[model samples]
Target chain A: MNELKELGEFGLIDLIKQDTINDHSSVVVGIGDDAAVLLPTPRQLQLLTTDMLVESVHFKLTTTTPWQLGYKAIAVNLSDIAAMGGVPRHAVVSLALPQSTPAEFVTNLYKGMKEICRAFGVNIVGGDTVSSPHGLVINVTVAGEVEPANLVCRSGARPGDVVAVTGNLGSSAAGLDLLTAGEWEDFDFAWPLVTAHLTPRPQVKLGPVLAAAGATSMDDISDGLASEAHEIAKASQVGIKLYAKQIPLAPELAEAAGQLNKQALDYALFGGEDFQLVFTMEPGNYEALLAAYLDLPVVKVGEVVDADEGVTLVDEDGQAQKLEARGFNHFRQEE
Target chain B: MNELKELGEFGLIDLIKQDTINDHSSVVVGIGDDAAVLLPTPRQLQLLTTDMLVESVHFKLTTTTPWQLGYKAIAVNLSDIAAMGGVPRHAVVSLALPQSTPAEFVTNLYKGMKEICRAFGVNIVGGDTVSSPHGLVINVTVAGEVEPANLVCRSGARPGDVVAVTGNLGSSAAGLDLLTAGEWEDFDFAWPLVTAHLTPRPQVKLGPVLAAAGATSMDDISDGLASEAHEIAKASQVGIKLYAKQIPLAPELAEAAGQLNKQALDYALFGGEDFQLVFTMEPGNYEALLAAYLDLPVVKVGEVVDADEGVTLVDEDGQAQKLEARGFNHFRQEE
Candidate 1:
C-alpha cells in the first residue's frame, strides 16, 4: 500500500472528487469549489463550507489558545464563503474534547467563535459535542447566501485576466515560524506576524465587492499564494504567470524571515494560512475594483494565460520556473 | 477546574445554549432542536445539523468497518434532519484519519457514504480532509429543507399529545452489546441485533408524513427513548409518561439479551444509538398518520403530561417511576 503522504493533499482531493456524485439537482458547484454552491431557492444560491481542525495536526495547544483555535476555526471556514463572494449567515460547530478539558476553556472557545460570528453577521445556530481520547478537535460548517449573479468561482478565470490579491502574505507564515521557535516576545518584529498567524481577518466584506466589480475567479489564500494560483488555474483550465517581486510581504515578515535566515518569498509563495483572497479579473475591471476598496491593500501580481503555459512564477532576476502545487500536507508530518 | 465529566451531556449543551444568542432573524430554531431550522428564504426553511464521531469514543474500528463508520456518520446527521421532519438535501463530510490508514479504507468509507446518501436523495457536496495523530474522527454536516409549516421542533409538544415512535427500540444497543461480547457468530439472534447496530436506516420517509399529519414534537433516539422524552419535556416545558409495556422490543434482542444474561428492557429504556424517530402528536392525528405509513411500524408509547408531573415511566405491573435521563455521556467514560 502506498502512503497517503505520497498522494499529497490535492491527490487525495482528486480521489474524493472522482467518486463524488451529486444526487441533488440543487447542487450547482460540488466538490472542487471553495464552497458547495446550491440553488435551494430560485432567488438565491446557498453556500456550504466545512473545515476540521485537529490537535497537533492543524494547531498545537502549546502554540495556540482555545480562543484562537475557536476563532481561527470559524474564520477559515468563512474564508471559503468569502472566496465564493457570499455572505456568511450561520455556522454549526462540532467539538470533540478529552475529559480533562476545562469548562472555562470550552466557554472561551465559544466566546471566540461568537465574537467572530458576530462580526460577520453570522449566527451560531447549533452543533454536536462529543468526547475524544487524545485531544480536542473542532469542526465548523458555515452556510452562506449569495445572489446567482454575484457568485464568483475558481473556474471563472480566462485568458487575459489579471491575477490579483487582497492584503499582504508571508506575514502569517512568518508569525507561525516565530511562534514555533518560541521566544517570540524577545523580538520586536514578532507581534505583527504572530497576530497574523494567530488570528486572521477573513475577506468577508471585500469578497462581494470584488465579485460585483467583475472579478472573474477567486480563492482564499489558506494554502499559500502560489498554491491558490494553481487551484484557480486548474479549475479554470487556464495557466497563470506570477512575478515573484509582485508577491506582497509585510515589513515585519521580511525582518523576521531575515532574522530566521529564510527568504520571505518562500513564506509568501509556499507558506499557508494567510486567509487573504487571491483573485483574477479583466484588465478593465481592475481600476474600479481597486478604487472602491482603497482601504484594503490590493495588488496585481500576475496574468491568466493559455492552459499550455502552466502555472509559472518569474523571479526578480527574470528566471521563469513552473511552480509546483505544494503548501501543507498533513500526512507528510507522519513520516 | 472540574473535569468535564461532571457537566454531563445535557449540562454542557445548556452551557453552550446559554450564551448562543442568535444574531440573525433568519435562524428560527437554534441549539435545542435536532437540527437548526433557518429561514434562508421566505418560501422555504433550511435545516443545518452537525455531528462528530471520534474513534473509540463513538465506535471501535475493531468491531465496525470503515464502511460502517462512514455509513453511520451520514446516517446520524440525517437522523437529526428526520427528527426535525425535514428532507435532507446535501452533506459535507470531514474526516480526520491516522497516517497508517489504508487507501482502500478511504475508498470503502466513501463508498459506504455514497450508498447511504443515495438512499435518501441526498448529495455529498463538499468536505474537509486532514490527518489525525490518534485514531479516526469523522464529522458530517447535513443540510435539509422543509416547508415552514412542516417543521417539527422539540418545543412544540403539549399536554395530551400522544407519544409516537417509528421502528422498534433497543435493537441497536442490543446489537452493540452482542458485537462487544465478541462471540456473536455463535448465536442466531446475533445477526439481526448486530446488523441493527451497524447499519441504522434513518426514518427519512416517515418523518415528513408524521409532520404533515400534525406531529407536535419530535426527536431521534440517538440517546435512548427515556433521554429523548426528557429532551421533549425539557424543551416544551411538559412532562411525559412512557409505559414500559408499550416500549417496543424485538424478539431477537430479547433472545440475545437472555443468552447474554442481560435484560432487553434495559437496552430498550436506557441504551442508545437506535436512530429511530420518537415524536408526539394529538391523539386524533395518530390514526391518520398510522394509516398513511401502514408499511412502516409506528406505535403510541406514551402521552405528554403537565410540567409538574415530570417525565415518568410505568412498569408492566402498573407502577409509575420517575425516569432518569441517563444515556451515553462520553466524558464519563474517561475515568
Candidate 2:
C-alpha cells in the first residue's frame, strides 16, 4: 500500500528488478546484461531490447539536459546491441512525457539522439510519443542483425579459455561516487568519470574485433568485472580465478579511491557501467592475441576452471580468496 | 502541481492525450486511431501500432484482472494491424512493471497475449521487459506484411470511392458509455458492447480480402468514423460527403441508442473504438463486394471529393450539412 513517492525512483526501480523472470530459449543474455539477444535466423539474428529512463530515476533534471537524457537513453540500448556482438541498424523510440515538457527540449533530445544515430549508422525509423501521466519516460527499442555463427554468449567459455578484458572499469562508478559524495571541488579530476556516467561510449567497433580474434565467449561488462565473471561462470558452467594484480586501473580512479579510502581493486572488480568487452580466449592463442592487441590492451586477468572450484580471486601475493559480487543487482542491493 | 492520485487513471490518460503532437510525415491516422498510418512509402502502406494496458491506465486494479488486460492489450494492437490492409506476422512487446507484480499476473498476461498470438499465428519473437517506476506498461509493436502493390492507406480514397463501412460502428463506444455510466441491466445488449470494448476482434483475416477486391483505400475506424474520414480526406486531398441515412447501423445498437436517448447516428459516426474496417471501393467493384459480404453488410454512405469542399454530412433530405468532429480528440480537449 506504499505510495510510489515513498519509494522514490530508485526504490521503485529496485522493486521492478525483482519482477523479471527470464526463461526464453532465444535469450543469450537476459535482464542483467547490456542487452538481450534473440536469434531469428542462422544468417540474421535479431537483437531487440529496450531501456526506459525516467527523468528522476535515471537522471537529475537540475543537472542533465533533455538532450543528454535522450542521448543516454538511446545510447544505453545501442550499448546492449554492442554487448550482443551485433550491429544496431534500426531504432524505435517511444516517449511518455508531461504536456508541459518544452518543445525545445524534445527537439534537442532528438538532435542528441540523431548525432549518435548518425555515427552508428542506425536509422530512427518509427515511434510513438504520448503524454505521460507523470514524469518523462523514454523507451527505446533497437533492432540489430548478427550472424548466428558470430554471435557470442556468456555461456561459451571453457576451462582453459583465458579471461580477458578490454579497456578499464570503475571510472563511471567512481564518477557516481564523486557525484554522490559532493566532491565538486575535484571537477577537473572527476569530469571524465562524470561524462562516463552520463554519455557511456558503447564499444560497438570492438565487437567484430574480438569476434575475429576468436573470442570463445564474450559479454560486455555493464556490471562490475566480478559480477560479470560470476555470470560467465554460471552460464558456462565453469569457475573463474581472477588475478587481482592484473586488473587495469586508471590513475584518476586509483587516486579517487585512495582519497575515499575505498579499495580501488574493489571498484575495478565490481564497479559497472563500463560497457567494455570481456571475453574468454584459448590459452594457446592468448599470447598471440595479447601481442596482436597492443593497441586494444587485451589484459589476461584469469582463466576458466572446473565448476567445483567456483569463482575466486587471487591477490598479488598469490593468496587464494573468494570474491563477492559487488556490482549492481537490479533486484538485490549490493550492500 | 496536483498529485497524479488526484487525477486518477482515466484523467491522467486524458492529460496524456492532450499534449501529444503529430508532426512527422502525413499522419493519415494519428493518436486516437487503433493504428496510425503514414503516407510517402513506395506504395500505399498501413502501419498498425498498439500499447498494452497494464494494471493502472486502461484497467483498474480493483475491477480488472491481468489476463483481461493482456488479452485486451494485444487485441488493441491487433485491431491496429487489422485497421491496415496488412496481415499480422511479427510483434514486439515492451513491458515495464515493478518487481512486486505477481508472477501469476505476468504469466496470465502472457497467456492472454499468447492465446491471441496463436489465434493470429503471430510470433512473439522479441521484446524487452524491465522494472518500471510504477505500474506495468506493455507496449506492443506489430509488423504486418502487406503486398506493396495492393497496400491500402487511410488517404487513398478518391472523392468517387464510396465511403462504405464493414460491420457496425458505435457499439464499442456505446459499450464504453454504458460501462462508465454504470448501466449494467441490459446483459444481452451490454455484454456485446462491453466485450466489444474490452476484447475487440480485429478483422485481420479480411484485410487482404478487401485489398484483393480492389478497395481504393482502407483504414480501421478506431476513432469515430467521422474523425478517420477526415484523416482519409486530408491525406487523399479530397473531401468526404457522408449520407447519414446510408450509414450502417446495427438494429441492436440502434435500439440501445434509442433507449439511452442518444443520437444513434452521432454514436455511429463519432463514438469511436469500433475496430471495423471503413474502406472505399471503386464504384464498379462496390456492388460485387457488397453482395459478397452477406454476413457483414457494407453500406455505402459517402463519397470522396476534392479536398477543397472539405467534409460534409448530407441529411436525409439530401441537404449538405456541417458535422463537427465529435469523435475523440486526445489533444483538442486539452488545448
Candidate 3:
C-alpha cells in the first residue's frame, strides 16, 4: 500500500483525462476510454493504449531484472487493450537508457518483450532508443483491433450489475511485498508470491469473451481494486461496493500475508499492479453468457448501486466504509 | 556541439533496432521503420513511430517551457511520420511527471500538444500519466497512414539518387546553442535559432509529397545530417556525399553561428533535433513529380553513390571526408 503512495501510477489518470484534448471525427473514444482506446476507422477499429514505467518509482533495478522489466511493460499495455475487449496487434517501444547501461541488459529486455509479444501474437514493430541522463524510462504503445460491437469502456457499469473479477487478485501485490521485504526464507512458500509479482499474467482471453457476453464495464486492475472501482464509478456515474470476504485472494498470497503480518484484503484493495480484470454485468446475463466460460475463475465480489450511495466496501463486520482514491486504510474511516 | 556531447540522444538507435523482433503477418515493416512503421494490413498501411524525450538529455525545463516541450514532443513524432511519407492521424502520449510538477504545467503542455494536433489534423487520442521519481519524460507514439506504393524507407536510396532536404538546416542546433549558452545579446539574430530548437516545425506535408514524387529514400534529420545520411547509406547499400556549400543554411542561423564564433556547417552536420525531412530521389523522377511542387524549398545537398565510395562529405575546399555516425569533426580527418 505504501508503494501505491510512492508509485502514484494511475491515481492521476482521471484528473488528466478530464483535460480536453482535440476531438477529431476519426476518434470513436478519447480520454475517458481512459483505457486509452483510439479506433482510427469504424470498420477497422484499433485499440490504442500506452503506459510509461519509470525506474525506481515504478520499479527498481535491484529487484527487477531488465528482462522482467521489459516483460511487465508489455504486459501492462496488453492488459489495457484486453480490458477494452481488443486483441493487441503491434507494440512500439520508446526506451530511454543511461549511457552507462550494459549492452546485454537491453538485449535481454527486448528478448523478454518479444517473448510476450510472441505469445500474444503481437508484433514489435517500431521503437526509439535514446540516451537518458538519469534512470531507465520505458514507454510502450500497443495498437490493437476490436469489433465495434465487442468494444468495452469504463463508463458502462450500471446499478444492479454484479461486481466481479476474472481471477484471484493481490498475489501480484503480495509478491511485490515479498520481493521488497526479501525476508521470506522459505523458497517453497515465497516462490509463488515472488513469481506473481515478477510476472503477473494478464487476463487477455477473458476480456473479449466478457464483452461478447455483455459485461457492463471492465477495467484492468493496474492501480488496486479500490482505485479501479472508483474510476469505474466516476466514469459510469454509478457506485460500487465490494465485499471483503468475497474478494478472491490466492492461497499462496494469503499464506504469505499471514507470515508477513499483513492482511490479504489490504493487498487486494490497495496493492496495485494486479493485472487481473475487474468487471460488472447484469446478474441475469451470467447464466447464458458466462456459464460456459465458468472455468475462467470469475467470482462475484459485490454489486453496483446508485451514485448517491458512493463507492464503499463492506467489511466482515457488515460496516460499509467509504474508499479513498488514495491508499487503503481500513481504519481511515475512524481517523 | 557541447549539447550534442551532453545529450547523446538517438546515437544508439541503429544497434537497438537491429535486434530481432517478431516477424508477424500483419507487420509489413518492423524494427527497421527504424522510422518505426507498422502497416496493420496490406491495404490499410499504418505508419507507427515512437520517441521518448528525457530531461537534461532531450530538453531542460530551464530552457524548454512546458508548452514548447509538449509542442516539440508531438513535432518530433510527426516528423517521423512525415519522413515515412505518411499522414499522421493519432498520437498516444505517455507523460511521466514529478510529483512536484504543478497542475498548470500539465495543462499548458497539453494545450501546446492539442494546438499542434489541431494544426496537423491529428488527434490526441490516448495517454497515460504517472509520477516520475526524477525529471519529466514524454513519450509520444504517432500512428499515420500511407499508400504502400508511396511509402518511403531508409533502405530505398539507390546510387545516382539526389540527396535533398526539405528546408534550411542547423537552425535547431543553433537555437539550442543560444538557449544554453545564453550569450546571444542580439534577439534579432538569436531568436530564430532558439525558436527553431524549441519549436522546429515538422515537414508533415512535404513527406507525402516527396514520397508521392517517388523519393527513393527518406529519414527525419533528427540526429544530424551526417548521422541520418549514414542510416540511409547503411540501409540502402549506397554511399552518400553531402556537398557543404549546397547544404541549405538559413541566414538567421548562419549569422548566429558566426556571432558565436562557430561554423554553420558543424551545426548542419552534427547538431541534432532538426525535424526537417532529408530525402532522396533520382534526377529524372524529380522534374515530373517535384517540378510542380517546387515551392517546398527542396534543396539537393548531396548525391548517392556506390557503397564502396562510403558515406562522406565534401568540404568547401572539395576535400571528401568520411562522416562518422558520431559527432562531426571538420579537422577529424587531419588527425
Candidate 4:
C-alpha cells in the first residue's frame, strides 16, 4: 500500500496510461494530452452522460474494494448510455483521491475500469486527477453513438404501451442486505446476490435490441422499477400500471430477502441499483420483441396508461394502489 | 443560507435546470434525459476534456463565493478545449456537495456557470449531483468540435519553430498573492491581478486563430510557462530556449512581485494558473500570425531548439541555464 503522495499526480497518471489500451477507431488521440481527439461517426447522433460517486455517500470503502468502486463508477455511467439505446465508445474519468490512499488502490481501480471498458469496446480517452483533502470521489463521463432511427427516449412512451424489463430485479438490494448483515458467506445462495450488488452488469445490448423492436421509451433501472417507471410516465405524460406478480425476482434474492425478514416484492419494486432495462413499447410490438428475445430474460410486467389514471400497482388480489416513487435521493434522509 | 438536505437532489437539479438556457443547435436533448443527444458536425473531429476541482485543495470557500467557484470550474474545463483548438459545444457538470451547504449557494453556483456558458455559446447538457459527507467536489466535462485540418497537437513542434504566448504571464499568481495577503482592496493596481486569479478567461478564439496561422504545437499555460514549455519540448522531442527578457509581464504583476520580495521573472517563469496559451509556430509564419492578431496581446518569448540543447532560459546577461520544470503537483510536498 504505497501512499498516493509518494506517486504524485503525474506518476499515478503514468501508471494509468501504461495499463490503458485504446481499441476504438474513432479515438484519433487517447490520453497524454490536454484533450482527447475523436472522429465522429457519420449519420449517427452522439450521446453523453456523466455520473459521480462519492465516498461514504455512494459507497462505503470499508465494505468495498477500490477495484469494485471503479468498476461501479464506470458501469453506472455506461448504464445511462445503455438506457439511451446508444453504443458507448469513449470515456473520461476524473478521480479526486485523498493523499492517504494507496498507489496500489489507484492502479487496481484503473484495472477495474479498464476491464469494463474493454468488455464494452469503450476507449479510455482523457481525464483529470487531483488530490482531495478527504475521501475519494470519482466522476465518469461516457460518450456513445446512436442511430437516429433507433434512438429511444423516455418522452416517447404512449398510453397503451406495454412495459417490460430485462433480467431479475431486487437482487442487487438483496445482495446488499447480505453484505451488510455479514452473512454473505453463511448461505451459498447469497453469492449471486452479493456479486450482483458488487458488480451489476449493465444491459447495454438489451437496449439496442429493444430499440430495434420498437421500444417507445427506455430507461435503465438505476433507481428501482417504480421510480424509473415514474420517470418515463412523467416524461411521456402517461401513467404506468405495474403488475406486482409479473415482476421477476431471482431465487437467491428471494432467499436473501427471507433471511432479512423482508418481502421480495418490496425490494423488487423499490430497491435501486438494479442496472436492468425498463422499457415501454406499443402492445403490437411486445409479442415480436418477446419472440426475438426468447432466449433472454425479458418479462412484460406492466402497461402504460393515460396520465389522468396515475401510476399504480395491481396486486394478486386485483386491488390497485397508487405507487409512490420511493427511490434513492442523495440529500433525502434515509428511513 | 438553507441546508442542502432541505432541497434534496432532485430539487437542486430542478434549480439548475431552471437557470440553464440552451443555445446550441447541436444539442437535440439536454438535461432531464438519461443522456444528452448531440448532432455530430460533418467532417469534424470531436474534442473531449474533463477537469475536477476539490474544496480546500483547488480553492477555499472562505475567500471565494460559490458563484466564482462555479464559473472557474467551467472555465478551467473550457480552457482544455481551447488548448485543443476546438469550439466548445456542450458541458456537463457533476457536483458532490455536503448536505450542510446552502440552497442559495447551489443556485448562485449554477448562475455563474450559466453566465459563462451563455458567453461562449455552449449549452449545459447533462450532469449528476451526489451528496458528499464533507467538502465540495466539482467535475466538468466539455465536448467540442474541430476541423481536422486545423487541429493542433503538442507533438508537432520542430527545432526551428518559434515559441510564443498570448497575453502577459504571472498576473494570476500575483492576484492570488494579493488575495492571500488580504490586501486586495488596499492596492488599486492589484485588483486586475486579483480578478485574473479569480476568473482567468479562456482564450477560446485565439486557439483557432493560431491553429489557422500554422501553430506547430500548442498548450494552455495552467502549470506555469516553464512547465508547459517542457511538455511541448518533451512531446515534440525538441529543446526549448526561452529568452527571460522577452517574457511578457503585466505592470501590476511586476509591482505585486516586488512587494512580495520576489523577482518578476521568477513569478513569470514558475507561477501557475496563468490560463494563457503557449504555442510553437514556424519562424516564417510568426509574422503572419502577429499581423492577424495585431489587436491582441501576442508576444514571442522563446524558440524551439535541438534536443541536445535541452530546455534553457537565456538571461539578459547572455548566459543560458537549464530550465527545470517547477510546476505545482497536487501530491508533491511543498518546498
Candidate 5:
C-alpha cells in the first residue's frame, strides 16, 4: 500500500465514494451533497450532517483552545441546519482525545458548547469517547427537522430573486488575521468577531424566520461568499452577480487588511466561516425582510440571472469580472 | 489541568454533555440511549443512528481490509435503523484518513459498500473528507423511515412478552475467535460467520417485516444478547428470563467453542456486535412470528418478567442462574 499522501484528499474521497453502499429507502440524498436527507415519516423530513475536525488539519491546538474547538464543531453542523431552513433538535458528539489532554480543557470545551446549545435549544444526546492515536478529533452530527412546505433548498432560487446576506461579512477572516499575527488585544473589544471566527453562532433562529418570510432559497456561509454563491447558482440553475461595493466590511477588518496590504473588501467577499445566513427573496418580500432585520443590516448585494451567464462580481465602477470559487476545499492542501 | 486518563471515558463523556446547550425541541431523548429520538411528523417517523470506528480501537489494520471496514461501518449504522423498525434510505460517511493511505484501498472499501448498498437499495448521499492526524477514522450516519404506528422502541416491552432473536447467535464471536487463533481451515466454510463478524448484514428486510408482524419492541444485538437484553429490560422497566437450553447456537460456533473449552452458550449470550435483531412479541403472535421467519430461524429465548426478578438464565437442570452483562464497553479495557 503506497502512502495516502500520493492519493491526495480529493482522490481519497472519490475512492471512498466509489465503494460506498447505500441500502436505505428513506435517504433522499446521500454521499454527494452538503448534507444527507431522509424523510423519516410522511410530511416530515430529517436532515443529518457530520464533520470531523482534526488537530493541525482543521485547527491548530497551539492557537485554538478546546472550548473554541468544541463550540466550532457544533456551530458548523448547526450552520448546515440553517442552510436547510430547518430547526436542529439533537446533536451527538464523538471525540477521540489524546491521553495527555487536561480534564479542565475538555470541560471548558463542553461549557462553550452548552452556551451555544442553550441559545438555540439544541440538545447533546449521545456520542462516543475513545483515545486518539494523536491529537483530538471531534465528529459532530446534528439532526434537524423541517416540514416539506418550509424546506429551503439551495436549488430553489429564481433567476430574478435578490441575493442578500443576514449580516456583515469578512469579520471572521479579519479576526483570523489578528490571531495569526499574535495581536488579540488590538481588537479585544471586537470579541464578537473573534468569537465568530472561533466559535461561530449559527443563524438557527433566522432560518425558519426567513422561510416564514418567504425567502426563495438559502445557505449558510461556511465557504466564502464567492464559493457559496456559486453553489446556489449551480443548484438553482441560475447565475449570481455580487456587488463588490455593497458588501459591508467591518472597520477593524478594513484596518487589519490595510496593515497586511490586502483589501478588506476581498476578505468580506471571499473569507469563510462567517456562519451568517445568505438567501434570496423576490422583489415583493424583500421589503419585509429588510424591515424584519432593520436593526441588523441584511445587505442585498446582487441578483440571480440565467445559468448561461455564469457568476460574476461587479465593481462600484461598473467593471465586472467573472468569479471562480476559491474558498476552502477540505481535500486541497492546507496553507 | 489533570490528564484525560484520570477522568476516563465516562467522565469525559459527561464533561462533554455538561458543556452542550441541549435545547432542541425535536430531541425527545438524547446522549444516553442506544440512539436518540426525534419527534416524528404526523403519520411518519424517522430513525437516525451514527457510529464511528477508529483504526486501532475498532479494528486491526493488518487484520481488517479497507473493504471490510467500509462495509462494517455502514452496516452497523443500518442495524440501528433496523432496530427501530425503520427501512433504511441513505447514509452519509465522514472519513479521516492518514496521508499515506492508498487511493486504491479507499476505493476498494467503497466498492464493498457499493455491493452491499446495491443489495439493500440504499443510496450514498453525502459526506465529508479530511486528513487524519494518524490512522483512519470512519463515521457513518444512517437515516431510515417507518410508519408512525409501526416504530418500536426499547421502552415498549411489557411483562409476558416473549424474547426472540432472529437466526442463530455467537457465530460472529466464534468467527472472531478463529480470526484471533489463525485457524483458517476450520472456519473456511463458515464465511457467513466470519462475514458476520467482519461485514455485518443488518436485518434490513426483517425490520419492516417484524414491525408489520407486531413486534412489541425491538433492538439490534450490537452489544451482545445479554447486554442488549439488559438495556431493553432497563428501559422497559422489566426483567427477562432466558431458557439456556432453548438458546440457539450456530453449529460451527458450538464446535469451535467446545474445542476451546469455552461455553459456546455463554459466548452466544454475551459476545457483542452481532447486528442481529433481538425483539419481544406478544405470545399470541408467536405462531405467526415463527411462520413469518420460517426461512430464517426465529428462536424463542425467554420472556420479559417483572423487574423485581431481574435477569436470569435457566439451566437444563431447572435451576435459575443470574445473568451478568459481560458485553463490550469500549471505554473499559477488554477482558
Candidate 6:
C-alpha cells in the first residue's frame, strides 16, 4: 500500500510511463510529449491530448457557473494542442454529473463549450454521459493537426535563445485569490482578475504564429512560470535565467495584490493557470516575432543558458537565486 | 433549477447537440453518432470516441482490483470503435484519484491498461493525472481508423435485414448477481460469470468481420439488448423483432440464474455491458457471414421490419410483445 502522496504526481506519471509501450508505427511521438503525435497520412500529423477537471479539486460550482466550467474544460485541452503548435480540429467531452444537477445547467455548460469551440473553428464530436454518485467530473480530449515542419516541442530550445511569453501572468492566480477572499464585488478593479480565473482563454491563435516565427520550443503556462520554465529547461537540456522585472503582470493583478497585501511579482512568478504561451527563440528572431505581435502583448522575459548554469531568477538588484520548481502538486498534502 | 432526472440521458444529449456546431471540414460526422468521424487524411477515416467510469457509479473498488477496472475502462472505449467497424490505433487515458489511493494501485491500473493496449497493438499515447477530493474516476479516449468503403454506421439497416448478435449474452448481468450474492466462490460454475462482469472482452476482431461481410447497421452492447435494439431500429427507421428462443445464453448463466431463482430470458433481454456486437445485414449476406464465423458462436436472433411495426420480442410461445427500452439510464431514479 504505497500512498500516492509518497510518489507525488510526477512520480506516479513516471510509473505509468514505465509500462507504456508504443507498438504502433504510426505513432510519431507517444506518452512523453505534451500531445501524442501520430502520422495518419503522409501530409499531416495528428495531435491527441486529454485533460480532466474534478470538482472541488479544480473548481467549485458555488463560485463558478456551469458555463465557465464547461468553457474552461475545453480551453485547458486546447492549450495542450497549442503547446504542440497544432490546429485543434475536434473535441470529445465526457462528463459525470450528480443526479441532483439541473438539466439547464448541463445545457448551459455545453453552450459554454460550444462558444469556445466555435470561436476556434473546432468541432464538438462524440461524448459519453454518466451519473456520478457524488461530485462532477469533466474530461475533454482534443484532436488537432500539424505540419511536421511547423510543429514545436518543449525539447527544441537551444542555449542563447531568448525566452518569451504571450499576454500577462499572475492574473489567474490573483483572480483565484479574489475568489477565495469573497466580497470580490466590493472591489470593482478585481473583476477582471476574477474573470481571468473563471474563464482563462487558451492562446490557440498564438501557437502557429510563434511556430511560423521560428520559435524553437513552446509550452502552455498552466503551471507557474517557474515550473513550466523548469520543464522546458529539463526537456531541452538547457538552463534558463528569468528576469523578475520583465515578467508581465496585469494592472488589475497589482491592484488585487495590493488589496490582498501580497507582492504582485510573487503571483506573476508562481501563480499559474494563465494558459499563455512560453517559448524560446534565437535572439535575432525575438525582435521580429515581437514586431509581428506588436498589436498583442508579448514580452521577452529571459534567455536560455548552458545546462550546467541551471534555472534561476534575477532580481531588480542583480541578485541571482535558484528558481524552485514549485507549483500545484495534486498529491502534495501541504498544498 | 431543473433536475437532471427530469431530462433523462437522451433528452440531455439532445440539449447538448442543440448548441453544437461543426466548424471543421475534416469533421465528416460529429455529435449524435456512436463515434465522431473525421477525414484526418484523404486515405483513411478517423473515428474518435470517449467513455468515463467513476467510482461507485461504474465500479466498486472493494470487489474489483484496480487492474480489472483499468482493463475494463479501455475495453469499453475499444468497444465503441468496434461498434463503428474501425481498428483502434491510439488511446489517451485521464485519471482522477483520491490522495489516499495507493501508488501501487495506480501502477497496477496502468499495467492492466498496458496489457490490453499491447495485445491490440494500440499505443498508450498521452494522459493527464490529477487528485480528486474523493472517489476515483477513469476516462479513456480511443482513436481508430477505417477505410471509407468498409465503414459501418448505425443507420444503414433497412427492411428485410437480419439482426444478429455475436457471442453469449446476459452472462455479465448474471455475474453481477453472483457477485452480490456473497457466496459466489462456493459455486465453481459461477466463476465465468464473475469474470465476465469483472473483465468483459470487447469484440474488436468481430467488427471488421461483420463489416467485410456486408453488415449494415451495427452497435456494441453497452446498454441492454433491448435498448441497443431500439437505437438501431430508430436510427435505421426500421422495426426490430427479437426472437427470445434465439438469444444465446451461456450454460453457466443458466446455472447461476437457477441458483438466483430468476428467469434467464429476462437477463438475456435486458442485461447490459456484454460488449458483443449486435448488427443487421441483408438476408442474403447473413448465411455467408454466419458460415464465415462458423467456428465462432454467432446467432441470428431477430430481423428488421417496417418502421410502422415498432420494436417487439417474440416469446417461446410465438406471442409478440412490445420490448421496453429499460436499459441502464444514468439519470433515472428507478435504475
Top lDDT model: 4
Give per-residue lDDT, candidate 3, residue A200.
75
Cα deviation at A203, candidate 2, in Å, is 1.7
A198-258: candidate 5 lDDT, tens digit per residue? 8777888888788777888788887789988987887788999888988876666766777
The per-candidate count of clashes, in order, stands at 0, 7, 2, 0, 42, 0
Tens digits of per-residue lDDT, candidate 1, A24-137, equal 444433443211233455566778888899998788899888788888999998888888888887777788877667655766677678778767766666677777889889
Please provide TM-scores computed only on chain A for all of the candidate models, following their numbering: 0.86, 0.82, 0.83, 0.97, 0.84, 0.87
DockQ winner between candidates 1 and 5 = 1
Residue B198, model 3: lDDT of: 94
- Predict model 3's lDDT versus the native: 0.75
Cα-based lDDT at residue A81, candidate 2? 70
lDDT of 6 at A271: 84
Better of 2 and 4 by lDDT: 4
**Model 3 over residues A254-314: C-alpha lDDT tens digits?**
7888877999988888888888999889988866666676566788999999999999999
Using TM-score, give the best candidate's number: 4
lDDT of candidate 1 at residue A251, scale 0 to 100: 81
* Model 6: residues with Cα > 4 Å off, grouped in runs: A1-42, B1-42
Q: Per-residue lDDT of B128-240 in model 5, one digit per residue for the tens?
A: 66767678888877656677666777777899999999877888887777667776655554566677789878898887788778888888887678988887887789999
What are the per-residue Cα lDDT tens digits for candidate 4 across A29-131?
Answer: 8998889999878999999999998887778887788888888888988888988988988999999988888899888899889999888888899999999
Q: Estimate each model's TM-score.
A: 0.87, 0.79, 0.83, 0.98, 0.80, 0.88
Show pairs that collide, candidate 4: none
Comparing 3 and 6 by lDDT, which wins?
A: 6
DockQ of each: 0.19, 0.08, 0.18, 0.86, 0.13, 0.19
Candidate 5, residue A46: the lDDT equals 64
Model 3 lDDT per residue over B1-335, tens place: 22211212122122222212223333322321101222343354666778788888788988988899989999998998888788887777777777556556766787778778778877665566666777889999877777767777788888988999988888889888888888665678888788889998999888888988889888898878998898789878899999998999989887888777899988988898888889889988876766686566888899999999998889889999988775422112212
Per-residue error for B181 in candidate 2, Å, reads 3.0
Superposing every Cα of model 6 onto the true structure, what RMSD results? 11.4
How does each model score on lDDT?
0.79, 0.65, 0.75, 0.88, 0.72, 0.78
Candidate 2 residue lDDT tens string, B7-68 = 33223333333212223332222232111222222332323343434334355654446766
